[model samples]
Target: MRYLVAALLLASLPVFAQTVAKPMNDPKTDTFLRQFAETRRFMSGRPTKPRITPDEKTVLFLRAQPTSATQTLFAFDVATGETKELLTPEILLRGAEETLTVEEQARRERMRVSAKGFTGYDLSDDGQRILVSLSGKLYVFERATGKVLELKTGPGVIDPHFSPDGKQVAYVRGHDVYRLELATNTEKRVTQGGTEAKTHGLAEFVAQEEMRRYSGFWWSPEAKHLAYTESDTTGVEKLTIVDVMRPERGGNTFPYPRPGKANAVVRLGIIPIAGGKTVWVDWDAKKYPYVATVTWKKGGPLTVLVQNRTQTEQQLLSVDAATGKTRLLLTEKDDAWLNLDQDFPRWLEDGSGFLWYTERNGGPEVELRKPDGSLAQSWVKPAAGFFGLARYVDADRTLYFYGDPNPTQSYLWRVRDGGAPEKLSTGTQGPAHEQFAHVAKSGGLSVATTQTATTMPRFVVLRSDGTRVGELPSVAVEPPFAPNAQFFQVGKEGFHASVLRPRNAKPGVKLPVVIKVYAGPTTTVVRHSMAENLLNQWMADKGFLVVKFDGRGTPLRTAAWERTVKYDFATATLDDQIAALKALAEKVPEVDLARVGIEGWSFGGYMAALAVLKRPDFFKAAVSGAPVVDWLDYDTHYTERYLGLPQEHPEAYEKSSLLTYAKDESKPMRPLLLIHGTADDNVYFFHTLKLSDALFRAGKPHDLLPLSGLTHMVPDPLVTQRQYEWVLGYFQKHL
Candidate 1:
């Protein structure tokens, strides 16, 4: 009788111990656990903007530098590793007063002056004068005297360049090319008859954004002539985006062409500096698409790269500058569209031939071709890596380039101009990032390095043989967070998973999970770099597991992975995400799948809404802000890329729409909260209005928060705080 009673007491004691396990927010075991509101308030500090100096050695970035409401730029020296004040508050105020008129001055006093520094500046070949643009006006400053000279005052002055002799400066003004002679103080119009409707010597919207060619003019080596492109937008389609600033007043429209649409026509022309007629380069515009990049050969014919609208076929053509007779120097084609290398092909000093990059055999390979049309014996074959262009081919026939032979990391590579390539810098083992700087006359390379998962970019100078000459000063990041937070990867079935355990996480404690997603076609949410991303860190600090992964349609990857959702964008990508979630649930036992929630912005918001509507079994709640519920609601350029034409593919568009899938409201789906800005031009406020109406008609429960007077990219502090509050509150309630 005594043994039986002891055995029963021991069994009952084990059961009682399981029931008394500490709660997630216990005072003893979970002393660091802060309330969601408190955590959010702690994280909602002032915003920080990054600034890089012209020299690339010092990073004059802002972190809480509050001399004023807007950011203030500081100066840092890499050599001494010291920082000093460069742009004083008095200087900024004076500059503001000089630029603004009397009526504008009163209004500007009330408005915060944001820091708008130099985008790109040029030092004169003699290094005596510096040319910089401040708010579209070109200002020349003497290096030693610090005196400012207004060279050419205009609204659209861009891409200003100085002649080799530093006697003349050329810049783009009002869609036309202009040359300023410093000696005579006279400005001459090189190209004429530019209008708002038609451009004469400047690139159009598509050429600038897609091809990455900002300047349309280039000066010859002798400085005696200028080569430029004139883009004609007479036949291109125009897109009008409504301005939500003033609801009573309608918006303005601009010309924008999408894929397979009629793009602006481009023509190359050369003008002599001595004042002559603009001679059009002879090329069959109908048969061969216009040139994207134009370069003059040293004492030889001019070279131009031409590609079709589809971008599958490419040709490097050499044209006679005197007569405009063109002959194809090299031709390459691919099954998919080829990326046009617009980095101004460098001409060897000898003028025998030039080097070109081709991905014809899968990856970028170097090809040395002669002046006529034959390939030189010296050529770099394709390797199992990516190759990028670096400036200057030295006298020893050594070509410099940079790449990551391994997809996981990047490094610089130097190839003997005629032979095989050799790795110059061995990057950090995991997720290394590198960027090459502007080549110096001394024949050395300036390189920037950042370890894996670091946001702060550091610079270093290296000799031609890959030896480090000097190290630049490091940029500062706030709060001193851990170097390694978390990284995610999609499984074999394409599901999302990330490891976000705290630095001192307990051995066996289940954590709530939050999925931060931006499942869009144009941009990917996941990348191996140091970024102070708001959502990822906010939830991670609140003891929630975070996960982010690319669906099928994100850009900057292989075409096969990107084009998988040709006509079916949402469905295919969503399946991969759902698969990822299921795999993560099986692997991570500490993940509380029952408390899973999803949140996103813009296109990501659309995915969050679909996750609850389509796969309610996986997520408990979702928060979507500025989502595009329907394809037809967006602009023509972005939507037409994946779905072809709306008239032809109405069914595909309908299937992809979230409104069509909102029929089954009786299921045990997660709660949804939709947020939008009334004045969003990119996604438009109508998206939420239409979506809300559909949800109401289907008898679905949703929360709608409308932000007034906010644009597509919301920068308002109050609006951002409210947005974060609404999202965090929704997840806490449901999850």
Candidate 2:
């Protein structure tokens, strides 16, 4: 009996061993994983540029290849899952021949010898034509027959916009707005072009970046008038950008208004659509720092949102269309900075009133007001979550909007006809993002739905009542790259951290950890979504555990969490991050305390640089890109929000400045990599340039990579690739 029992135990022991010894690269598992990775890469490849179609029946999107070398336009039916390819590189090159003359073709051939091929284009309002600019000249393509029409046979014609009536196209040529009548086949200048001395109908550097505004003009709904802003830079200081690569050509000095410096004087004007004299609107000439938001009302007044120089106070003014008389409707003031909404304002059917978004009561909410400025109703009350822009307001008076009810995720909510709001969909644990397209006649909504963490983004059509009508076809599945990634709560403050582990990580393996952080008031890094950040993945693949946390001061969370770091922005946010990290290091044994690196860009970059300077014992290395080393160095609109005015709180600015905390000659800190573009007008290249000198004076060893001609966003691919390589090399050497 004893011998028989031993035999049974031995058999069970072998079965247990087989179950424990799992293969690392099982064929079925690897195939599924590869497919999952491919799916993610494919979705990432989908062009995220805003899609706007004429009839609103289809969405015109740009699709790019995996390598991002080839891109084409695709039309996706909003109602159906059907998709049709509209343009490709080969097709565009073939169509270019029909549009260009022999000499013009030869010129483009010469230019293409070194230039990257064209990729972006805009479709006409009727959806039957597309205006594509390749090599330089604008070419109009007939979508049905694939024929081409040469609109402007010239050297420079950029950013073309179709007229509302679809009979003409307007573009920027030589810094002036130019109109090209498609029917008459004639070109006319809308404004006198700007030279070295003057700039007309085009935005300057500060306005474009800090204000989050671009272009100089907007076409009226009737297509008979063009409303534009003219910026006079006669008084603004000029910052010269020297091009060392082509020293013989010399450099250009642009009107760059540094902090506390004089900015351009701006004013609004309306011009005849055909071409005529300009009519300056009724503006307060004393208000030199006026910013305007012009929107055309159906048959009534034109709403213009105006702000003062300091950007602390904003007023919504309705202007009489014919008389040009302005009347102030509503006013909003913020102790820090008033938020601006660039989206199209919602107007009622009768044109008697409209909806406005304000944070007057602490949280961003909606308010309905009459044309005379009196409050009609409270459309949305202040809540814990932030109220996003209203997507659609139905005739039944139910307002549909997108907002993060919880800091970690966003959901669609519908406020009944002047009633309380209700969550629409089944709330997911992770982040959920919904983008809507308005149904033309019925005012219904179509959405591109995506749930993060486990599910992929899919398109869905929803009824007015928020019921799903149908689901569009899902994209091919990609391999699981960051399956271990999960959002962990940091406490009741709604603070959370996104944690990702190495793919082949084993229990008890002490791996180096990297924290990609952005502790800012306007942007949040951690959210519920399937989108994989390339930088985070690269670090994880190299055996480093990557984590991203949205501490206090980050936006999209509760008002308290966002405003907690108000006066002491960097200090409070960094302390929260370090506290979270220490807690994580103690709880997760896989995290190695001896090896920790921090990285970020812009505001995040500011925090990253501060992390190593303030907490060198916790952070080993830091990589900062275009960081605002000093709060006073940044623009008024963004910096003032958290730190308040420099005069109001000088100590806060001094403490937050990275330069102020530079190590003494004997007391040094961790290795730091400081990167900036030579022509970064947004944060100013002087930020890193000044910091480099400060670090040198302090005898701290650091590496500096100054990219030439790169802007704040770093749009150049070569520069971006170098940035990635530098970040990886820094972590590899130190972390």
Candidate 3:
């Protein structure tokens, strides 16, 4: 398989046009663009939402269709080694267009899901019934009879989940949470007093965008209770996102928490499954306002993790399910700020203790705490970097997790309750470069996706004992292009970077450079995964040397390394990019730094614009997409967490904002292209427009391309393809 992958990579290289200069829209480039946009994505066959049954006999996953951006349900029988399609969008949609409600569309945007037809689904505890929401409607699929039933649950339903016992389906409609009985066909509202400004059982913008918390409610193991969040956004400022393209349709006005602004008032409560008095959890809402996480076990008390506004201190509280009384179990603190860890504060099977993760040992470590909040045992393996815990298979008395000692490689490992951790993934297959696994809780089964530096994603099903069973089929067609990146570390910081020269460039020829970057907090562009650098390869194919790196402030590093930007957001990220470029330029003499260009989206977009505006000597051109020009305009939770309140640190605000440099005469003029979606609610079209206004006032020459009706995500394939062409043409003109 490794040799086959290498053969495919060599075959995909662009055929050089030796005789004449080919048009930019040549067949090769078109094919690359198509693969980059449509061919390799939705319907091209990638498995999502993998579910392993309790019995471990079946593995269910959603597979995309080849003809459309719709997903179909597939089931893999482990015993028989057979993969079969269970349901497709054609049968579920019945040829009807998937019409998403406004609320549902926003939710999908938050979750970054652009595909249609059953984007998400929930499986019952018994794995007998599946609850699916399609086009704002609810449907249930039964495994025993292979039947589908649509429940008339009204309009605007979102975030549906089945009860632990599979007796009822609970979902959020309008602004409140509702429960529907399966047998009686009866519906009941669990909590009341939900309005446009106050919502129940739905994640707020900060929780979804910053904290990575998607759902606002969790069902108890007994199916008799539910713990839901009630968020009141009356304090946060409201912003209207207008659609200038469609004058007939008005805009959507919702709470937008800007820097130094008020955040939503959130409260947690427990209610009976059949509708009863709501028991609100009591905690110091003033001090610890942010509910970072919530977890409920079958026999344990409800657990909540809350943090203060500064995020320096976080407390784990256990709430009484009946009385709503809360007891502070433990408090974790850091001098800078506490980072949210995934799958932390997990409950043990016996319910006598729980598992928690910490970095107090100068590295990542796992701690077992008794029910009384006293620490029982703590374990930290050498070089076990801080990836999240995957699962704790009680049957095997082992816990599985993901971690990487090397920055570019990751793997799966299992450790006994009080024993040394052992690597579970195989290294012989492909070096185990980048791996992810989902270990089933009940059954001794696990599904994993393992990819190497040169290999495409390979999905395999394995037993808890590391026995390989079968592989999930990928319908995706290999792209007619391949990446050839040289990975290395540079500078005293040992910054990770990948340098890709133009594939078609002549030997010893000088090439213009393009630094593709997403040098943002908690993100790294340089990695060993094949999917991580495809776009970088395409840019290199277009005749520019492409560079990518993870500088200061990116995660997967030490807490000190990531906290470099806690008080200063712009310096480390930008300085490191420049340093990496200079270091690589010294090593690779073919790099023509005189004609360098930079491009990025969101935070990277901010970096791109910042590079040309603040350091025009290094970057000659920039393409900024939906850039957050001003830190003050960003959300309170994210911006404040890094730069503090704008009101308190006015100097830092002025220095970090790009608007401050818009008219600086000290910096020389550079060609820049500003692209933004007018319907972008996260960064807001106002950001780009305001920056453009500043540039116009300063008489700075620049180009602006505004996309209408597109949100933060550019879901249209045509637009995505055209975007690459535009950027390429702009670079050609400037460089």
For all candidates in order, the CA lDDT equals 0.60, 0.64, 0.80
- Residues 617-690 of candidate 2 have per-residue lDDT tens digits of 88998888889887777765566656666777788788788888774454457888777766555677778766
Question: Candidate 2's error at 332, in angstroms?
Answer: 0.5
Off by over 4 Å in 3: 1-23, 27-29, 40-43, 380-382, 426-435
Whose TM-score is greatest here? Answer: 3
lDDT of 3 at 208: 87
Clashing pairs in 2: 33-479, 35-478, 35-479, 36-478, 36-479, 37-478, 37-479, 39-478, 431-528
The full ranking of all candidates by lDDT, starting with the best, is 3, 2, 1
RMSD of each: 11.5, 12.1, 7.1
Candidate 1 clash pair list? 397-417, 455-530, 495-580, 496-580
10 residues in a row with least lDDT, candidate 3:
13-22
Residue-wise C-alpha lDDT for candidate 1, range 642-697, written one tens digit per residue? 66566777876888888886766776545887777665545766677677667666
Model 2 scores a TM of 0.82
Can you give the TM-score per candidate against the true fold?
A: 0.76, 0.82, 0.94
